[model samples]
Target: MANFFTTALFPVMNQYFGMPVTFLIHGVICLVYFFFVKTSVPETKGKSLEEIEKLLQKG
Candidate 1:
């Protein structure tokens, strides 16, 4: 999926926005994705296996 998008969409973006802007757009997208996952995902860093299972069952 990523390869297809890069091969197909990248050229169109680069043509209109140039390589720098295209890269910046990708960077901003990555940052937004990072924050989205960070805030929306659950953390199980210190959880035991049973605790994790319970959390999953609740959800």
Candidate 2:
């Protein structure tokens, strides 16, 4: 998925913004994505599968 976006957008981004700006934009995008997932996803690191299933089922 990341590869797909990189391949599809790299040319357009590079053409418009050049390599440095393109990389900065990608970094910012990744940071935003990281925070979005961090906040919205539940942590199940120590939980059993059954407990995880119940958590999701509650939602």
Candidate 3:
């Protein structure tokens, strides 16, 4: 998704704002997705599948 937006969407946005804006937009997107994944993605390090299932159910 990120790569698709960067390589595909960014170019379309660039037509309106130019290449530098496209670069900045893509950079910001990458930064946001990086933090979003880092914070929201669970570790799942040692938890069992049943444990995860219960956790999901609770939410």
Predicted structure with the largest lDDT when compared to the true one: 2
Tens-digit per-residue lDDT, 20-58, candidate 2: 999999999899889998998889999999999999898
Query: For residues 1-59, could you state the per-residue lDDT of candidate 1 as single tens digits?
Result: 75577678888999999999999988887788899989877789999999989988887
What does candidate 1 score on TM?
0.68
Full candidate order by lDDT, most accurate first: 2, 1, 3
Which candidate ranks first by TM-score, i.e. highest?
2
Pick by lDDT: 1 or 3, better one: 1
Compare candidates 2 and 3 on TM-score and give the better one.
Answer: 2
Candidate achieving higher TM-score, 1 or 3: 1
The estimated TM-scores of all candidates read: 0.68, 0.84, 0.61
Ranking by TM-score: 2, 1, 3
Q: What value does the lDDT take at residue 6 in candidate 3? A: 68
Over the full model, what C-alpha lDDT does candidate 3 score relative to the true structure? 0.80
Each model's lDDT: 0.87, 0.93, 0.80
Off by over 4 Å in 2: none
lDDT of 3 by residue, 1-59 (tens): 65665677766898999988888877887789889989887666799999888877776
Clashes of 1: 0
In candidate 2, position 48 carries an lDDT of: 100
lDDT of 3 at 17: 95
Candidate 1: pairs in clash: none
